[model samples]
Target: MAKKKKKTVAEDDLSAEDLGVVPEEKKKKTTAKKKTSKKKTTTKKKTTKKSSKKSDFIQSSCNVGLVGHVDHGKTTLVKALSGTWTEKYADEINRGITIKLGYAEAAVMQCPKCNRVIAEALANLLRKSKKDPKGHCPDCGEKLAFKRRISFVDAPGHEILMATMLSGASLMDGAVLLVAANEDCPQPQTREHLAALEIAKIENIIIVQNKVDSVGKERAIEHYNQIKSFVKGTIAENAPIIPTSAIFQANVDKISELIEEIIPSPDFEDLNEEDFLFNVARSFDINRPGISIDDLAGGVMGGSIISGQISVGDQVEIRPGLKNPDSGKYKPVITTVKSIYEGKHSLETARPGGLIAIGTELDPSNTRTDQLIGNVVGTPETLPEVKNTVEIETHLLEKVLGAEEDISVKPIAKNELIMIVVGTSLSAGVVSKIGKHNSVSLQLKRPICALGGSIVALSRRIHNRFRLIGYGYLAE
Candidate 1:
């Protein structure tokens, strides 16, 4: 009796219900394992959904031009902000200057804080945030999210390329005037670029004091003051000044924050409904020499849409288009927009206020070398009338810019030939008639698309090269 019968092997393996005695420890372990498996399955499903969501975070695109004197870090600042060196030309890289208009785009992101308090139980099971590249916040172990995307047009800041700067200015909703902290404020190009901004009426500006890392705090402060004074009484008088070291990416985040705050996308509710007006800045033959007829690409025009919207396959009429040698009269070039591209992003349609590249069906011979730079791409029969004779309400500046001597801006004399820039189009205009104070009518050598109140940049040859003298508005 003391030596009880050996417990049967079946009895030891009995189920809790069969044994009449509950196996509480085993039951708890089983429940815990099931819960963990469920949690893992739920987490994997959630992560799959979140990762599938496309990043259409860029709400609306705005062009912000970076303008300043040569060697002021305009290109460097662009590289810092967008991680791209805009100068793609060989000569530009060799010369260490932005020769043509450079372009880059970047997205500004922010950390996504944990909305739910990190409970001890849930903390270990939480997923990483999309906003924080590290997946988890170091402080509270949260995630991050994307904020906005901004496109920067890095314009050449050289004195000789003021025309290019002005052309780029026409596409900007705002501008960044870079002033190197190591150099004196109000460098010639800095002043000149600021003045050009004023003429273009670009009110939103951010003044960047770059190269601060190369100087001490005292020197940086001095440069800041110089910048404040230089901008005082000018268009950028109220603009914010952000000190940064573009070479080292110091305080570069501040610049991005400022851009998002100051250059908010424009309200295009009304403008988008109006007729389209695309200013052709640069056009080229993208086809290579060896390409066969079947594989040859069409002509590509790169520029910004000043107004309205254009979609793929839209029939557009280019005004003052390819001048037909046989017919002296200007003939409109009719073509369909084969494709539209904004930066590296492709789009089916393009709206006002962002740079776009349009591929068209046309003769490549007509587009190479920027021969069609100043043309307007618009709806057929809906574009503004092309004019060979333009009457302007001129307002001459007090002095000529980019000149060795501070020459006073003189009144337009009859028969004097001068350079004219309207939108992105450039032409030579001969003053045929002079009217009252700051009024003149000119006969243009190249026809241009002129609206009733379009602004025109006026320039004259002062020391061999043409210099910006003043701006004018198209007469009614």
Candidate 2:
């Protein structure tokens, strides 16, 4: 009868105790693993939230300027990025020199899973003839429905076009310095541009050593070394030099990545809707009455708003001249945004970093180039004084001046004049004082704004025309 007793299900299945396994210990280990995994999941969620907030602040909006020596593929690189020809003029393409400052618009997106920044995808999406209204992340397979508007200014690089280049760079937050990889070193214009950038106080620069396909790896490396030597002790000394071929579309993706890293995002919180500043580069009257259009608007002055909001009837100010005519002079002009255009479409209100055209009581013809226009416009802060004493950091061209020599010590007598170009304004000034330290001072023949830390160009006043002499940095 005892042998016939039925075995329990737990005993038939081999209980932990019978198998010499410790049930209490096994249960404790399993519980520990569950708790650890739960903590890990919670930590990961918190990290993701923090990362999202940072991204929102850093990628709100961005602006990049294209600069370098002539024929260094500035326009080509821009076209490659946006897939739209920025320089459409036949003469400009044929002459191999950008005649004027050009502009184009695009958007940037980010990945969901990997959270990587993406460019050119928006340009590609916009290129489609059909309204593909949706976007996806290139890195992760997740959907990227958000968009950030971006603006690109294509600046000319020729020495003769220095004024145009300065105008373009003055408005940009970042610069793309394109150096041809085939050339042994940057040309004279390249040096001139570097000086101009220094004068503008532009700190962020991305160097693109283009034309790598033509030169191949060996020569490209050689040219790259030359670039390194050329940029020594300059703001661009440690700038990332990306070797690319715009014609071949090689390393084109890297351009966007570099831009995303260098350019700072617009500060949306401190921005104002009506407080706008639009520098007038090109202005003309339209067929419509009481309305004018600025083809190439200069520096846009307004607070950044990332939430996609702007409205019409916003009051703005317009400053007609570059150097302040009066110490505290501002011409307040009220205008409503007659139309807002983003990339070729019209919108009632434009998000930040998008091109906007406003219709106002101010005549476009009256708005001259180099003028600043904005809402709540006040006299621009007085630029550094143009004095008789000039302190400069200079580089001599053609062995005419020595780097270590104080050329100004043998003072040019009174009425000795030289050319000065800062930002978009160019004028002549006479040597007023020459100090013991390679420092020389000039009292501008015509009153012009010469800010401290500005780069000043010295030219021989021959035939009453300014001839290229040398370059110097303004000092306190």
Candidate 3:
């Protein structure tokens, strides 16, 4: 009976094979994905590949000036971005107002998933699960894109520093106008700065409603509406108003995004080919009193390049240089640039549209105390001609700005000496001739380094201060 059962089982197995039912293998097999070492090795290789690709990023390409009323926190906003407070002087810190043009630089990075400058809190929330320092947000699982760096020019908002603000305007590709959320929409300097921007033709602007932490959301919205009405029919009529708390850094990421969107780097084919034109605003003697002659550094000139490019070791000339006592002619100063500095970053070459400080091989005496201020620097024999007599087409405004007295603008009369600001160059000019409407010529007291088609700001001493009356372009 046992032999008969065994024979039957064997017959059944043979019959199943004949029916194409295959037997399964019982040996255990391991997958490469489950091997811990192999998985870690793959991840490490991917991370290294991403790290190598992130080294290329664009630095700052243009300068953005900060403008607003005094004590409105323009410098504070700069600090929030750069982590460096721009108020370097003791008086500025004590007085709680920016006295001069303050500069600071910051890089704005964008999120790879959303392509936005994520608010710090939001970014933290999104990246909570990611262990990689510069890796993607865990929520979106995308990396961060490093955008360009930006330089901020924090200009004084005091009524008296209108000329300095105007000069700073010349250096800006666009401007960020700050309006305090705790105060009224248009302060005196706020109005004046907007007017100055109009005169300077800086059309690209972003209005920041600052100090949001000091006000409720309702109050902030009221200020926002007020700002809209204030800028109605103005150059900033179409500009975006971003609400932020510069002190607490609320919505500061939006400021970076707005800047990138509004003021892009201007495209100019002649960035490297044209003759360089640098308007000197500030100069310094970096030497200490105890420094020896061998250790004394060359003089440094600070300002922005208006056009073209300059390089270290380039032979340059300063227009309206020291007057030659014997020849009675102003001989342009000939010097070589020992180094170039933008903010704290040193560079071998500098292009137009950012604050630049040139270290020149000249006596510290010439550049000390801003002695070389109001001068123009450029390649030798390539600078615009120095003009003591300039022909201008005047365009006077309808009303005087920032004046306690509500006075209508008076026409520029013959022999009327007025303050003229061309680029960063300041001069006093007498109206030598007046033709038809908006047509007038001036004989300047201090010569200006100017070319045809240069725009000049005209200021008259209204009461006690030089108020911007109008602007005109030089006749070619």
Candidate 1, residues 1-476: lDDT per residue as tens digits? 42243222221121111111212233345557766778878766755674454234242368889999899898877776666677766577789998877777665545466433221211222334445434343346655345555667888977778888888888888998899988897777787788888888999999889998899999999989999888889989999999888887666656766787788777778988999988888776655444457655566787887778888799899998888788777888899887776665556777876667787777767876677888998989988888999889988889887776778988779999988888788888899999886789899998988688988889998777888888899987
Off by more than 4 A, model 1: 1-60, 114-144, 326-329
What C-alpha lDDT, on a 0 to 100 scale, does residue 147 get in candidate 2?
A: 44
Off by over 4 Å in 3: 1-59, 118-143, 323-330
Residue-level lDDT of model 3, residues 322-413, one tens digit each, is 66669766768999888776655556677775666788888876776666778888888888788988888888888887775667999998
Report how far residue 140 has shifted in candidate 2, in Å: 6.0
**Clashing residue pairs, backbone N/CA/C < 3 A, model 1:** 112-144, 129-143, 131-144, 131-145, 374-425
What C-alpha lDDT does candidate 2 achieve relative to the native structure? 0.55
Give residue 370's lDDT in candidate 3 (0 to 100).
Answer: 66
Ranking by lDDT: 3, 1, 2
Q: Model 2 off-target regions past 4 Å?
A: 1-60, 88-90, 114-116, 121-142, 145-147, 266-277, 286-311, 314-317, 320-358, 364-413, 429-476
Error of 2 at 110 (Å): 1.8
Better of 1 and 3 by lDDT: 3
Give the alpha-carbon lDDT of every model: 0.75, 0.55, 0.76
